[model samples]
Target: MAQQKVKRLPDADVEAIFGAFAAAEPEPKGELDYVNPFTLLVAVVLSAQATDAGVNKATKLLFQLADTPKKMVALGPAEIEDKIKTIGLFRNKAKNVFALSQQLIERFDSKVPESREALETLPGVGRKTANVVLNIAFKQPTIAVDTHLFRVANRTGLAPGDNPLKVEQGLLKIVPDQYLLHAHHWLILHGRYICKARKPDCWRCIISEWCRFEPKTPAPKGS
Candidate 1:
């Protein structure tokens, strides 16, 4: 069978969808736990291929021990590995975490850089990760296209694209200026809770009226 074409939402529909999201959640925040910008960077790095809940769980003690670059460097890779062993790719992530800490201490003067280029220079920090750090840490209007955001953007016809970068660019171009800052959180929360991959709870979706997805899934039988 041929793949169905995803229709792009019009300007008015996009505005309405975001407006509904804003009304429902005026200040959407990322689920990641962090003490400061440095901890936020560490959390986002450890969150690669890992769930927010899992990352938060692992980082609870870890952050307490090493919330700063100097502290993380002092903890060393072995300790970091042991702390994050429950997460996937713990070994490599630990190495990246340690290296990034050292880099921040030596190069950035123990500070998390706000620029995307500088952030990406750190180990394990990519475009998506950098975007998250920029948006959450620095309050930049950046859309980090993670799995949830990617699915929601495409499925809802908000910013359809084959890859995350394309979807990110598409969203950056279209999402209204007023809603851009919180748009990332809104889409991510909606995707995680309502517009899920296996089965979206379309009946409860706030912007279902503007969604271009066909045959919306109904709420399970009798509530």
Candidate 2:
């Protein structure tokens, strides 16, 4: 079967779509729960391959016990593993959580570094994780292209790309400066609730008129 080529939204449409998003959600936020930059970093690290609700459920108690690098090191990998056992790949994530905590103490003076390079140096911290921390914790204009973001970006013609990095770059280039800071959260929430993968809720989407996806899913029969 041939792959369908994705259409890219023009700058004006992209701007308008984001403007609508901004208007709808003036102060978007990441769903993951965290008390501070350190906890936020840990939460993002644990969020890989896991849902925000799942991560939050595990981290709620974990963060209360050890929200800082020093406290996390004291809790150790074993306790961390026990707490996050419900999450997928719990063992590996626990190891990373402990290792990253130790690294923070040794290298970063128990502080979460603001730079992407520094954040990526920690265990299990990748581009997506770093982008999340930078944007949510540090208030930087970095977009973390998760599955939801990727799907929405491609489906809406907002920033079609083969991979997350490509999509992130495309969004950085196209999204208006004012919307860049909260664009990640807005798109993530939109994809999760409205622009779903199996059946997008196009009927209710505010940006549906501008979206390039054809054959938009209609409202279910019998209003």
Candidate 3:
């Protein structure tokens, strides 16, 4: 099927949309919880194909057991798997978690690298994970186009693209500087809770006025 032509929102509309987002959530935050950059990195890796709540549930004990790279390596892949067994692809994720921990110690001296390039070198840490770490942990103005953010970006015509990388680039180019830092978290939240994949909740959306999605989703039967 041919893709619908996405209407590009004007810069003025985009500014107002972000203004609404900022007013609604002055301090947006990622759902994943972590003690530090290393733990945040691990949480992001575990979040692939899984929900934030799921990752947090598994990481509660895992982080306690090994928040640091050295400690994580000491915990071993087997134990890592055991701890994160609740998450999908636990075995592979465990291996990645352990291997990445080892890399952090060997290559970066046990500290999570601040640069996205260095972060991507770690096992299971891809562009999305690196962007998440860069934005959340290091406070870099990087946008991580996760499933949620991708939907919001494209659906709203704030920055439409076929793939995540394209969407990421589009957002980075147009997002206002003042709102850039929190833009990622805001878009993710908007998509996850408002512009859902199945049916976007346009009725209660904060930026519905500026969104480009047509035939906005109507309110359900019950108020």
Candidate 4:
């Protein structure tokens, strides 16, 4: 038998879905810990293949010592690696952090850039990272498609795409303007906790009604 095809949701359903999310959590926040835009950028860069919890554990002390570009540059990659060695690819992440910090100081006067193009110019700053920085740090209405967001977008048929950029553009075109600013956070959180990759807990999902995922996961036996 052929698998059920995922269908794109209607505009009204999308509105209702995000409306539910907004009503449930009016102000969703990213889990990564950060003291400032600079720290947030560094944290995201470190989170490439790492969990937010893991990143937070390392950054707790690391941020205290070097939360600024100047301070991070002073720390050096070797010392930085020592701080975040618990994470995967710590050595490379440390180098990127150090190099980007230096670039920030040399080019942007130690301030995190507002434009996506400028942010992407830094080492280890890709489209997703740049979008994240723009949205969270600079308050731009950009969606940064991480793994969670990517899965949720496809699974829910909210903005299905073969790649992150396509889904991001689709979402930007579909999501209402009022919800665009926080859509990244909302979708990411939902996918992380409820719309899980293995088995989405649709029973408790706030927006499950509007979601188009076939055969929604039922509550476990005798809950």
Candidate 2 residue 174 Cα shift, in angstroms, is 0.7
Evaluate residue 145 in candidate 3 and report its C-alpha lDDT on the 0 to 100 scale: 89
Q: In candidate 3, what residue range of length 10 has the lowest lDDT sum? A: 1-10
TM-score of 1: 0.97
> What overall lDDT, based on C-alpha atoms, would model 3 receive against the true structure?
0.91
lDDT (Cα, tens digit) per residue for candidate 2, span 9-115: 88999989999998898999789999999999988888889998999999999999998999999998899999999999999999999999999999999999999
Q: Model 4 reaches what TM-score against the true structure? A: 0.97
lDDT of 3 by residue, 72-175 (tens): 99999999999999999999999999999989889999999999888888899999999999999989999998888888888889988999999999998899
Task: Write one digit per residue (lDDT tens) for candidate 1, span 75-167.
Answer: 999999999999999999999999999999999999999899999999999999999999998999999998889899888898999899999
In model 1, what is the error at residue 134, expressed in angstroms?
0.6
lDDT of 1: 0.93
TM per model? 0.97, 0.97, 0.97, 0.97
Q: What's the lDDT for all of these models? A: 0.93, 0.92, 0.91, 0.93
